[model samples]
Target: MGPRFFGYRDRVQDELVREGHQVECVDDRPSETVWFKSLAKISYHFTDRIILHYAEDLAERIAKEDYNMVLYLGGMSFCFTHRQFSLIRKSSNARFVAYLWDAFVNCKRFGQCRDLFDDIYSFEVKDCERYDLKLRPLFYSNTYRSIPLGSEGYFDYDACFIGSVHQYTKFKTVSSIVKELEAQGYRVFKYYFMPSRVAELWCKLTHRCYRGQVFQYESLNTTQVVEVYTRSKAVIDSPQNGQNGLTMRTLETLGARRKLITANEDVMHYDFAQYGDVLVWNSDSDGISGFMRSPYECPPESVLDSYSIKTFVQTLLGEAPPYRGYHNDDCCNETEDAS
Candidate 1:
């Protein structure tokens, strides 16, 4: 019924609530089922609503609540806005936690929120290096060796993507990636758009710049999305930061026991990758092409042998390794050497 979009905010809110933690989502837009049903379904298991444009009002609201913490999603301006943070600090009584997508690029925008956050969660290791500055490496939970949990070592799905591309770089990057996959004879379908309800209108207006495959693409529901990802042979599960988490697709895909090809090598290195040979790595530009020709298969028993969902949750909530200062000395030494 309102401006709906399926992004990480819903996932974040849903997770917090599932943990029985009270959560207040602050955003300028509303959740329209026509636009964000898949998002709500995948991320939230219960009823949900927007704050009717709680841009800065959330600050005062938080100040009055009895919450345990405040989680700041990546703001609407693309990076964390100073206004949002200021209001959060002004509004809440709980510990301030900032969840950012990219640690490298989006950092400069957190002039106030940076100091206000009690913990920071970044999907990037570069952010881990500065955890004392409020970085929480919670994304490094355990990796699994199996898929479809109950199903033996079999996945019916093929290749898939969970996150989306909206801006200039994102559009270019995602469209190019999909085109690249297509060039290699892979079938790719993406459902992410600006906002679900107004997606058509916005696309029509911005088509001159945000040109990609809109007409050819139609949205899919959450169940269908997870079904496809789990059934596929491989899922494109890495994040570009500012586009973080183990990636909802990563967890859901692995939970489904499908092979994963992701950019989140840091987590893989943290002991999750050992679960199976199903994981595909593509760090360099050319590596992606190689994977296109020879996609990796999802490993079954290995994922179970490596990590579990409980452990994954602990990591997300800051109960695992990758805590601040783990590799600080080495990083500092390396930096000094270069200088």
Candidate 2:
């Protein structure tokens, strides 16, 4: 009902609930029969109808609740038409806010439907600057807290990467870095999501060593993800092609108290980077070996607290700093329908 489908949303809901907000989650993408998903994938017109139905169903349920806020996390709009969104918007007197996690790729859809939300926030600062959207970077879940059980010895891998091979740049960067690490005799684990059966077979044939690690694109369970994050000495990340900002992987590394080796130069702007908690390097750089050998430096407690899920939730609710530019006084006012 909450963040079950999307882990980041779940973490935000958990933080909001922990802070004493009675939260009611309406899953925008409810589990449906496999036949339903297969049909939705085949026909664009049918997909629209299915999504419209989902939105109407969700709106009806939400209209019954007394929620003071309605936050539409990313991906809901892929299914919702302007008509569906408007119906949901009018369902309650709640302040409507949207936080976009994939503005880099979904910019046009967001731009076309800008007026649907009373206030909009994006993880990419460029979106905020270029589109007048409010700036809000991603945050790490509190569940990544340090374990005092001294369990570091249980893991055999020095570094690990868990993500997809959808983008060519992402796949090339990760594969190159991991291959280099393996050549250097450093144990590394990687999980890549192949887009098709053919792609999976190709990966299995070419990279025989990674045969068991590759899988089809789908969601990985949170417990399994956290287990890998906590066990590894360092986590690896590569930004999307043309991406200039940080992703949840950067936040996850911080949350787990593990060092990060990323291609994201944005990390240099943060305080933790100055203290060597995170290293910004590319596949061609020789610094990774030395960086991997060094013990991870824990960033200051204040820095850690700043990037926590609680802070992100508080800021979204307009109860803390790093505000999202929406005020309670103007929150109830309706904007022009840009549909």
Candidate 3:
């Protein structure tokens, strides 16, 4: 499988291979070289069709292959038209399935080819409710289990959140929460997409909002993230505004068997909450100290196994697994409450 962000595609390939299924992976992205990528990033602002040529080229390659299943993961900025989808379908006897992890923001672009896919799955609960799509929570790889925990002295912070920030209140809420935790004598190591002071000034000068960052540092890679997860006592989760579903950080915390401090109170309604693995804190609420002082309880092995990417891939391939942990109905009441 081709490498992608979070190594999610790599995890999928590993799981399918472990199940003894022969899988061939293909990448749809173009311009992997530094110079080409720089050019693409610059040209993207001038024309929406900057990536169209790449997509059409990839479609031609996909059309030449015959497979039983063609799965697309996380359609970020890729543009695929109906004609291209039709060509892909005609070329392969494979079932076209697209799994979108970022359905909330990318819906408009990804939804364009929704009818072309045989099966569509989204991580967002509201998207499923509104668009009649299947709801699947994001998964975590079992590899996290290899990281030994309980080494408190190794970390400088009690909790850490390494993710992108934005202009929205969700990210602003995170900054506030981090300060609150610090005031309560808890240490927090927070990182966002803000790269430099120059960039921040540029945004202000141009009157363009830095969409997902405040102060900038280079984002962590997979190895660096796993290292951080191993050292930290808990990971903080702050969902983007209007997104009711759990982020991958939630599942990653579960995989690492670490504690979770989240702004999403809806998580309290899920079965995983029954295990005491998570502490839900809202910006409007109190009790930051109590929750921080609470112990991290290890969830049952069954619970961990249920949410593994292995089981998720099996379910995707039409296998009935014993543990299908969270469902759309489980979050229905929470959704209603939020509305």
Candidate 4:
């Protein structure tokens, strides 16, 4: 697996090891040269070459190891071709499984190698229906659970938002919500992050919404994120356009026992939302203040346990049952999704 923005690859590996299984992780895009990394960001052809080489090396290594299963995370289409997948399959008796945390539109390359896996799972319901894969929601790492829930009236801020600026729409929505909250005398903590200065500069130049906005260059570690969540009464989530799956932040907020203010209405269908812990908002909506003031209703322990990392890994490996709360009859007609 490649290095995810939040070190999920490392966390997943750690969980597998804790479950008494030996694990070896190979970087999907392995390289030491700075120039290659820079060029790969701009050139798909160059990145494909790097991925092909890495796949060849990994195939050889897998042939030598007595592995029982090979789990391919998000980067399968970006990393392997049909030929390379065939070579790896021929070289190993291990079961191949894939789990996509992104939508099909974002990682459409998964289509090319879909049949190579014994089983496939996706976080997006649309992707599951379109690709005939199992539907799974993202998980909250144990780190979020470690955060002690603050007592009522002791929160440092009324609300908080800590996420990368992925698009102008998300940036604008978050800004508006923060502005509205602050205007109402609510102290809101905002941590807007951009991956690099170049990306920040490019967005500012291209989008008017980003022109005067400040963004953090480095991302917060899990500890820092948990700290921010711990200090706040609620977390704001602005999902990307066309995304239907719940984001890692949404799950983390639940794990931390914080109220959620989200743009995604699909959350209302979930079992946890039945108690009014989540507030669905839009640019024109009201009642945000009331929702923020409302006492947070904790979901059942079973509901929280269903979305934990342990359950996530177990379900992925077929050692435990998948969470059934994700599926609902009303979910099919929903126009918006989260994350």
TM-score of each model, paired residue for residue: 0.58, 0.79, 0.80, 0.92
lDDT by residue (117-231, candidate 3, tens digit) is 7877777766766776666677887767766767546566798988876444656667767878888788888776655666556655654344344575577876888988887
Better of 2 and 4 by lDDT: 4
lDDT scores in order? 0.49, 0.69, 0.69, 0.79
Regions of candidate 4 where Cα sits further than 4 Å from its true position:
32-43, 47-49, 75-77, 330-339
Model 2 lDDT on a 0 to 1 scale: 0.69
> How would you encode candidate 1's per-residue C-alpha lDDT over 7-83 as one tens digit per residue?
45665555556767666665533344444545544442222233223434555566667876655555232222455
lDDT of 4 by residue, 1-339 (tens): 544546777888999999999999876556736676676566546667666777788889999999899887774334456776677777899988888877876664557778888988787777776656787788899988888777777899999999988587888888888888888899999999998898899888888878777789878888888888999999999888788688889999989989998888778767788878898877755888678878888889999988899998998798987567764664443312221
- The count of backbone overlaps in candidate 3 is 5
Q: Write the number of the candidate with greater TM-score, choosing between 1 and 4.
A: 4
Off by over 4 Å in 3: 1-3, 29-60, 149-156, 195-199, 202-216, 322-324, 327-339
- lDDT winner: 4
Best by TM-score: 4
Worst 10 residues of 2 by lDDT: 330-339
lDDT of 3: 0.69
- In candidate 3, position 68 carries an lDDT of 74
